[model samples]
Target: MRTNQSSQEEVEKTLQSITGIERASPNPFFLTRVEARLAARRSAPGVTTPWAFRPVWVAASLGLALMLNVSAVMYAREALTQDDQEQETVSLSAEWGFDATVMDW
Candidate 1:
């Protein structure tokens, strides 16, 4: 009876060892596709960018920014000057060909 019990345990162990051995992996060929894509990318020609590191673009952007800043500053100064001149009487002389008679105090 003891020998019979040992044989039964050996049979159970052997069956457990081979469980799921026939199961196929999902998408077993995925690595091959990835490697092929990588190889193609490596062998392909390098692309040239027509506008990368362009000096003209850099210069133009800088010039536009500077012009905008100067314009804004000039406008702000002009507005402040107009506000400050409200209490004064501006007189236009005949040398400039204009009338000079106005008092807005």
Candidate 2:
């Protein structure tokens, strides 16, 4: 019972100490200045955001990337087809028993 009473008194003292405390507030012109800066930024030109959000630049970049990818794909396909043709020719020559060493000018 005595311990409980002491704890209650301590809690009361803590609450009393906090009761007279004042609330913190920002500077009076702080919000005004922040709003003004935001407005100025919005009105300013040539502010580039992230690449994905820019209108003209994003479209152009995507178009260029697409063209490069298509070109790469076409080149790779051509290379693969040429390699396949060479392999087929070698296989056909081997099957037909054509000896390169026996060929004389």
Most accurate candidate by lDDT: 2
Which pairs of residues collide in model 1? Answer: none
Q: Give the TM-score of each candidate.
A: 0.37, 0.46
Residues 8-99 of candidate 1: C-alpha lDDT, one tens digit per residue: 99999999999958987769889999999999888875654457357898888899999999999999999989966743423324455544
Model 2 weakest 10-residue run by lDDT: 96-105
Q: What do the candidate models score in CA lDDT, each in turn?
A: 0.78, 0.89
Q: What's the lDDT for candidate 2?
A: 0.89
Please, what are the lDDT tens digits per residue for candidate 2 over residues 1-105? 999999999999999999999999999999999999999999986776777777998889899999999999999999999999978877877899776346654
Clashes of 2: 0
Scored against the true structure, residue 22 in model 2 reaches a CA lDDT of: 100
